[model samples]
Target: MSNNGDVFVIGGVEHMGHVGMMHGVDPNPHMSLYAAKASGMMGLTAEMLGKMHGITREAQDAFGVRSHRLAHQATVEGNFKDEIIPMQGYDENGFLKMYDFDETIRPETTLESLAALKPAFNPKG
Candidate 1:
């Protein structure tokens, strides 16, 4: 629920974040140009680039787990107080809502759980 009396709930969508803006024009050929193949090529390119630097799924997942853990720890320890600004407002139903921290972090993620995910970019893997 938003402060503007609009009830907003996020459903699940993955590729929308990548192939979303189909009508927009940009200097990057990746945007609005070859919209269908853009995502695959971009991911493959990124995976190749990472491979050049010796980054594998294990390394990537380890970094992600470490990242979430560090981020949660930092937030809990008030390390981001200087950068974070708390916002207080009313919900769509007029209930008071206070937001002071990141809500998207999965702090309890484990390396084993992360390993369950298939490598999307690395086709050979």
Candidate 2:
């Protein structure tokens, strides 16, 4: 997951393409280098690195809150207007609508809300 490699996609019929990668997972444990030391999930790796660097949960939550605040502010200021392309997607009620803004951006996210989230990779942590 932490390999510095390049991926090439060979084109074919619509949506059908072959992806070639310089690095990937190996089935054999004895031949694998990072399989035992690192997790396949990036979140788990990030958590491990954070713990190694002495980054506390409170600090992480505060950072997440700050990031959400900045993203929300940028969206309100129309900073992403030129960057985002409006796409047609279905709503929760199956109504089709054009989405211009990032739907995943949670403007209401706060440190309290983030702190309430359990560790996704290691629950005990």
Candidate 3:
């Protein structure tokens, strides 16, 4: 038990070598969201498991809506400040800006809006 401020982190099976490096996929690229999907580690597995679990599209949409709502709520309640590092920079217009919150989340998201979204990777949809 020591408190020298050093932290050790371990990740599991999240590397290209773990998936055996399939076709069109990289042999040494870092494990990323796109890589995971291309490597059939998440895209196919998630779809199959989600269907097996009987999680309907509407349920997935509802969960996404809830996630965005909770994220927005956390931002408004100032809880986001604790989890993120502050960013201060200029936009494309060269105007200086200080970003302190998550601007991507929308608390006003609805089920209908989420339902409109289609699967991006799957072509059979």
Candidate 4:
């Protein structure tokens, strides 16, 4: 996926942000150039960018929870399990062949727990 044609990046005044190569998947690349005019984010810290765009911390936290849920599902369901290779496990001395899927699933993804959990980002500040 190496291309030397051009590069296009896009961001919004809102919390939403996205970036992609111009020659790759983006059909209308000029829109990214247009968006950069108002974003003023040639390079900016997350907090700084948020402040510049009036992105509230509460709103960011809400979006973080939603992203966590989506990631939890994909990880637990082994959405990309087919990419895993079958490995061998040994008991005592003999070789035991086994296939491992996902080992990160907990049966506890309730909303109550999610609410109780602290913010998972920007912990230093």
Candidate 5:
């Protein structure tokens, strides 16, 4: 929602409702994970990124760092506690009760690691 304009185009492409032209997907609800991952890995077209937001490499790096931080914060603040399902579910009565939050959120992502990641999108070398 923060980047509405960018999301809009991707959403519009989805709203077109053409399956054949869309790589065998109905572009109305949500894009397939395969498509999203492929697109993410392949990176965005220069024209597409340009039309959405004038994001630079530096900005992208900062965004990634901030996103990691936000995830950590959300977990720490118990905002996602309800969303988590704990393991070892059997209680004394053999009833399943969740007792912990998922600890998959990374709070220690470094700038070096972020820099090492491949670019998700770019315009020119």
Candidate 6:
């Protein structure tokens, strides 16, 4: 006999809810030090790590473009139809709408557009 089990994992982030504290909180001296030295923001930390790993900006931009392209292609081909369920959500204009597709997928995203954008965490980089 064999033991079997099924596991389902789901994770998401609501950036709007943390807009005010995007840099993170410094609740104590230790946290303050950590935040000051190693930026409490995940994006900033990732930037630092990428720099340390010698990952070039062009590489990151290319990766982002490729990701958007793949997602857009999948959406157009209805590849995610079975996995995605329609949900009630508010639009930017505050109107109630049924979101049946992945809203984050940007079909128009391109390498030039990504390259023109400044780094979100490190503007200098």
Number of the top TM-score candidate: 6
Model 5, range 20-82, lDDT digits (tens) per residue? 333543444355454552453213444355446676656666776887799889888989778
Query: How many clashes does the backbone of model 5 have?
Result: 1
lDDT of 1 by residue, 1-125 (tens): 01244555544434546654333434475554655433444556567556666767787788789989998999999997886678987778999999787766789999999988777755575
Model 6, 9-85: lDDT tens digits are: 65776574547744455546576454454565667666876776787888888878888999899899999999789
Q: Rank the candidates by lDDT, best first.
A: 6, 2, 1, 3, 5, 4
Which prediction has more favorable TM-score, 4 or 5?
5
Model 1 per-residue lDDT at 39:
46
Off by over 4 Å in 4: 1-44, 82-125
In Å, residue 27's CA in model 2 sits off its true spot by: 11
Model 5: worst 10 consecutive residues (lDDT sum):
7-16
lDDT of 3 at 97: 92
Q: Model 5 off-target regions past 4 Å?
A: 1-47, 50-52, 85-104, 120-125
Better of 1 and 2 by lDDT: 2
The whole-model C-alpha lDDT of candidate 1 against the native structure comes to 0.69
Give the higher-lDDT candidate: 1 or 3: 1
- Quote each prediction's TM-score: 0.54, 0.68, 0.60, 0.35, 0.44, 0.70
Model 4: per-residue lDDT, tens digit, 1-125? 11324765644453324653222333454855755533433333465556656766566656566756775687678775775566767646577857464343444455566556564334532
> In lDDT terms, which candidate is top?
6
- Candidate 6 clash total? 0
Number of backbone collisions per candidate: 0, 0, 0, 0, 1, 0
